[model samples]
Target: MRPIDEGMPRERTLLSWRRTVLAFSIASFALARLALAESLTLAESLAATALLVIVLIVVISMRLYRGSMSAVGVSTFIVSATTFLLGVIEILLVLKD
Candidate 1:
């Protein structure tokens, strides 16, 4: 068995964490606006759900990134995909409403 490249993996993991933090921050701000709209609708609920899923994905990615034997790249991809999905859903919900 071989040991992992400690420094590189840590750097990549740190980048993933930074990205997740930024994505979550943006989504949180957007969610506030969606929640405070004139009427409560299904669109708002869907947007909220998307944001929640993004947050969960980010948290899970970070956890997986920190593990020694796990692959960090895949986790990063998952995080990015979820973030994109969150944004798309938010847009769709807002437009639909």
Candidate 2:
């Protein structure tokens, strides 16, 4: 059993993270606008705020995750999972409203 090449895999992972973060940020902003336009309830507004915060955190994490081996995977997983969860929640909220 041979270990995989470290550099290429890491680079690909980083690029994927970058694309995910960009998509999350853009989707959050779009949802925020939709929520604002539709006069969302306080709870919904708070959810949007949470999504925005997650976007910011993910963006920042990308920078910090670049070279730190120990923390990179943790940050990437958190961002990716949160992004998917938030997207689902947003869709449900919009439909519920």
Candidate 3:
């Protein structure tokens, strides 16, 4: 068996978190564009943009901290779940109209 590199797991975890953040950012931008093109009011758009910014900031912080991979995992799940729900809601709204 090959000797394990102690830092490899942490490096992989951090890279996974970065990829999660990138995916979430893409999804958020798509949703925002859909909202702006469809039925979102200016106030609603601003609020959503603010929330996305805050979430992104937190995720980035978790990635940079290096204290705990748990924090990164949890934040990644939160962002992914939130984006999925928002996408579903937006689709429903679009279909309803």
TM-score of each candidate structure, all chains considered together:
0.48, 0.55, 0.59
lDDT of each: 0.65, 0.66, 0.63
Tens-digit lDDT string for candidate 3 (45-68): 745774665576555656555664
Per-residue lDDT tens digits of candidate 1, residues 19-89? 76676767755765675564566446655665676676666666665664365667567666766866776
Number of clashes in every candidate structure?
Answer: 0, 0, 0
| Ten-residue region with minimum lDDT total, candidate 2 | 61-70
Residue pairs whose backbone atoms clash in candidate 3: none
Candidate number that wins on lDDT, 1 or 2: 2
Model 1, global lDDT: 0.65
- List residue ranges in candidate 3 displaced over 4 A: 1-7, 40-65, 68-77
Question: Considering every candidate listed, which one attains the maximal lDDT?
Answer: 2
Model 1 stretches astray by more than 4 angstroms: 1-16, 36-67
In terms of TM-score, which candidate is strongest? 3
